[model samples]
Target: MSDIDPGQARPPRRVRVDLPGRAYDILIGAGLVDAAGSILAERLPDARLAIVTDETVAALHLDRLTASLDAAGIAHAVVTVPPGETSKSFRQLEHVVDAILAGRFERGDAVLAFGGGVVGDLAGFAAAIVRRGMRFVQMPTTLLAQVDSSVGGKTGINSPRGKNLVGAFHQPDLVLADTSVLDTLVPREFAAGYAEVVKYGLIDRPEFFDWLEWKRAPIFAGGPERAEAIAASCEAKAAVVIADEREAGERALLNLGHTFGHAIEAAVAFDPARLVHGEAVSIGMAQAHRFSARLGLCPGQDATRVEAHLKAAGLPTRLSEVPGAAIAREVLMAGIAQDKKVKRGRLTFILTRGIGRSFIAADVDAAQIDEFLAEELAG
Candidate 1:
């Protein structure tokens, strides 16, 4: 990571995602929602837009989003879905597709996904299939969506078998992240999204991780600088996404905690009835750290530190408390076997060498994995 002078802190900044015809810019800051029209005006001129959001976000931010569209004079319609993970399903995707068709959405009409990962995934999946593919923009409202799911173009729906088991690589035309949206998230949800933000540092940027460890308080303060930090995290993610838009190889690195996380979600029955994606990812990251240490890929001390930070942030770090630990492990292994990363019947686990270093582990035996998970369950 390079350093920008403090003098440039307040300057408007942009990170570009390169993907041939699908390339886009991610704009991160406060008041970005107000600038949505202008941003779209520049990038998506002459496009009819459909704003897809959930009931919760529609209440909190719809007026402003509509106002922005009004300001930009972008002809658009607002489609609201019921809030929660259930919205990411074939039923919901079909409903959105029908709505888009009814709205006469053309191939170039932009679908603006304006909520968390669920909304983005569901709407993006619909965009992928609707009329054979329409353009879309990502307006991630939650921290988790902003840092991880929304940028990579890996859009999909969860099936009874697993999470994100059905989807496509439909990248957004642009990503608009207004950090002000973080204000509407409850504390726990906010903490959950922050977990993914910390992940960027854990996966490859030790210096950024150090900054997070030190500035955790200010980052959560919802200030302009916090918006900058969020933007920086998106910048890191956008760079990785530009290189691998389809999770072919290096892009799978983004799944650092998700392999275990998705399994936990599946085990819990994809319950917005109880478990949240970020919560599951927190516990999964801890489990990954423990498993990595057990495999000697990372020092035990690193796992201990990760545990401390997660716990301090109110993220659950173990499986024992969640009931059915063995079932969770079994289901998680099943998901890993089906993970897009598997090759020739072998799984590729992205284990850490320490806080800032990670590598592919293609030969970690199942027995060792089971033992490590068993210990996590017991601990």
Candidate 2:
């Protein structure tokens, strides 16, 4: 049972991502969706909003948001796409851009991404390119989006060549992460998002990792720990984004498990049923630790501990755990090669020395990754 009451209103926690001239705040709490209209009305008083969401989120949350907007007398339009990873494509991007243009949204107007990472990415990209980049706001409805994607300015659509191959660094004007919305997620979806929460600890907060292990149940049960975890994760990400908004340097640390994870996602064709982003990241983080240990860079026990914690959280920590047909080593490697971190054919990965010690490893040998993939696939 949840320790927090569903109808209770908690004051929102704020994490600020302070970029040079485009700083934004991520407000996390219950009832944010219901309060969004007044919030937006206060911040962008004259600006009309184009709410871009997906079918799933729209069905579950559109009314609440629209009702709030209506209450505040804020003018808005909605553009909804099909749900899931498949919607983060060029076709959907075109559709969203066309809709915004058709609605005659001006540069001063805002594009509100009211879904998970896919919607945030797709809608943000549309906001970036349409009308030469309209103001963007993130109203992320999923755990994954709330803790990770919603804070960063990274926006894009997946290309046939690889995941997130086409995108832009368009910062959001504001981010509202309503923790209450997480209750509507299926267990698997919530677990997948929890994988990302674990990532912050893995990247550089060993104490946070230890805390997660102790508080896992409460988090899953929607206790105060759940909100605490989200706020901590956001703070971690905001620090990184503040230091390296463009991912030119330290921001890459945030992708600690993403290289291998993205490869697995690409191999599985980004199918949520097979493996969602957070689940792939769980596997990738485990693999990264294991690989680091294999290369004598990290302690083997740390890798085991990571896998153990992820498993306890109901996250898949191995590629073999991904459902459906076996993922080919070649396909996995192809996906890695197209990773955004790759530079001039040299593979760049976020590897760790141990818990809370992740770092960027540029110019990693491709052969080593191939060998690792072969071993993982064989298992």
Best by TM-score: 2
lDDT, candidates in the order shown: 0.79, 0.89
Model 2 CA lDDT for position 216: 96
Tens digits of lDDT, candidate 2, 1-379? 1233555576788887788888788888878888898899998888899999998988898998999999899989999999877888989999999999999999999999999899999999999999779999999988989998977788999877666889998999999888888999999999999998999999999999999999999899887788899999999888888887766799889888898998888888777779888899999999999999988899999999999999998989887888899888889888889777788999999888999999888879999988987887787
Candidate 1 segments whose C-alpha is farther than 4 A from its true place:
1-12, 321-340
RMSD of 2: 2.7
Q: What is the lDDT of residue 184 in candidate 2?
A: 97
- Pairs that collide, model 2: none
- TM per candidate: 0.90, 0.93
Q: After superposition, how far is residue 352 of candidate 2 from its true place, in Å?
A: 1.4
Top model number, lDDT: 2
- The alpha-carbon deviation from the true structure for residue 183 of candidate 2, after best TM-score superposition, in angstroms, is 0.8
